[model samples]
Target: MEWIILALVAGVIGYGIVIYNGLVALRNRVRNAFSQIDVQLQRRYDLIPNLVETAKGYMAHERETLEAVIAARNRAHSAAQRAAGTSGADAGALGAGAVGELASAEAALGGMLTRFFALAEAYPDLKANQNMAQLQEELASTENRIAFARQAYNDAVMTYNTRREQFPDSIVANSFNFTAAELWQLENAEARQAPRVSFGNR
Candidate 1:
């Protein structure tokens, strides 16, 4: 009877250890995923100015849209800095905040880019410019990468959240300060309402 009781106790302790370790691993994965998203976003930021300059020469009348995109980019850069500092604490909130920053900036940039293209339709010379075409293609590709990175970040958060919310793992997570990761959501609710009509007439 003594030996049987001791074996049962040992099994429970071992199982608990496994659960704790798994939770830790999942938490780390979430952090790493966020870092990857940041790296890609930074790459996109560096590309923005080059894009702005490329678009500028062709469309002098697009001053307002171009300015908005630049302003949004600045705000996104600031928010990213804040997110970096407070990582692992209310990570969901921070991730969401960062997403807000990047999304807002990207939206402004996208809007301006659309107008830039539409305006380009009127100017055959601008359309035929090698630099403009190349920049446009690169910008499109970078946007795709940003989207993919966001998906990866969400996937990591989902795995971490699943473990954190599970029965035995929740106990471990609570004791160790590991918590559920938040999904990055759009900050602008109004933008969700429509197909996003351009500021200027089509």
Candidate 2:
């Protein structure tokens, strides 16, 4: 009976190790997914200044709209940087807050971009400008990439969260302090709507 007890204990210990390692791998995947999103977001931030510069000459009258986009972009970029710097168990609460802030800032930026594009409808010269057209196309591509990355990151987070919350794995995850990752989400309903712009007529 002593040998039987020893084998049962060894089996439980081995299973715990496996669960712990699986959680660690999932956590790493979540981190990698977040990094991908960070890269896309950085690309978007870099493109914004160029977009605004190209709009300046033709959008002189819409200065407020342009300024709002720049301000929101700056806020979002800063929040993203802060969130990227966070890690480990302490990162759980801090990262969640930072992610929430980033989402709000991004939503604000999206709204400003939408308004700016709407105003651009009246500026035929702006629509006809080759530089503006190119910038618009690049920004659209970056937006699509960001969307894809965000979805992937969220999916990873969902998997990690589920594992951490599962029965037997929960015991191992909690013991190892494997906190849940926050999912990326768009904060604004209006931002979900594609910007209403029609440059074809121009």
Candidate 3:
């Protein structure tokens, strides 16, 4: 009877260790996924200033639109920094609130960029500028990368969350304080689409 009880105890402890390791692995996957998004978002943010500068000469009268884009870009960049910091701090440190803030800021930036592009459509010279075309193409490519990264991040979060919530895993997760992660979601439907970067017939 003593040996049987000891064996049972050892088995339970071993199972708990396995669960803990799995949670840690999932958490790290989530962090890695978010970092991928951060890289692409940084790339997109870096392109915005050059894009705005190129437009300034042609869209001189559209100062408000230009300024709005910059303001939005700044806000989004700040939010991204915060989210990245949280993910880097420690395992399970990246909370839902930080992800939500980043998503909101990104959506706002997307809206501003959409407006900037719509306004640029009126300026034939801007649309025809070789520099503008190249920047637009780059921005569009970055946007695609961001989309793919976001999907991967969300998938990782879902898997992590689900695993943590499961019965046997939940026991280990709760004991170890493995907090749930949030999915990056754009609130605006329009913002979900990448801005139209095409310079048609120009």
Candidate 4:
């Protein structure tokens, strides 16, 4: 009877260890996925200034729109930095509020970009400028990459959240304080799409 009880205890302990390891792996995966998104977001932010500079000469009269784009870019960049824990927080430990702030900032930036492009459409010379065309193409490409990275990050978060919530695993997760990861989601459906960067004729 003593041997049987000891064997049962050992088995339970082993199972708990496995669950803990699985949770750790899932948490790390979530972090890695967010890092991918951070890289793409940083690239997008870097491209915005050049794009605005190229438009500056042609859209001289549209100063408000130009400034709005730059301001939005700056806000989004700051939010990304916060989400990435560059503010001295633990990396990849984004709470729901942090993720929401990042999403809101990004959506605002996308809206500003859309408005900037709509205004640019009026300036035929700007549309025709080779430098503008190149910058637009690069921004469009970066937008697509951001979309893909966002999807991957969301998927990883979903998986991590689901695993942590499962029975038995929940015990380990709760005991170990493995907090839930938040998915990155834009509030506006239109904002979810890449901003229209095409400068071609209508």
Instruction: List model 2 lDDT by residue over 1-202, tens digit each.
Output: 9999999999999999999889888988888888888898999899889989988998898888888889988999998898888744443422657677777788888888888887888888889998888878878887888888888988988999998899999998888778778877776678665444346665
Q: Cα lDDT for residue 82, model 1?
A: 63
Off by over 4 Å in 3: 91-93
lDDT minimum window of 10 residues, candidate 4: 86-95
Per-residue alpha-carbon lDDT of candidate 4 for residues 43-83, written as tens digits (9 for 90 to 100) = 88998999999999988999988998999999999888887
- Candidate numbers, best lDDT first, in rank order: 3, 4, 2, 1
TM-score of each: 0.76, 0.92, 0.97, 0.94
Badly placed stretches (over 4 Å) of model 1 are 1-10, 88-109, 186-202
Clashing pairs in 3: none
Looking at model 2, how many pairs of residues clash?
A: 0
**How many clashes in each candidate?**
0, 0, 0, 0
With candidate 3 superimposed using the best TM-score fit, by how many Å does residue 19's alpha carbon deviate from the native? 0.5
**For model 1, how does the per-residue alpha-carbon lDDT over 1-202 read when each residue is reduced to its tens digit?**
9999999999988988999888777777777877887786687677767767766887788787777667766776666666665566643324445555555655555555455555657756666777766766666666677667778888888888888888988887787767566676644654332222122222
In model 3, what lDDT does residue 82 have?
Answer: 88
Ranking according to TM-score, highest score first = 3, 4, 2, 1
| Stronger candidate by lDDT (2 vs 4) | 4
How far out, in Å, is residue 160 in model 1?
1.2
RMSD of each: 4.7, 2.0, 1.1, 2.0
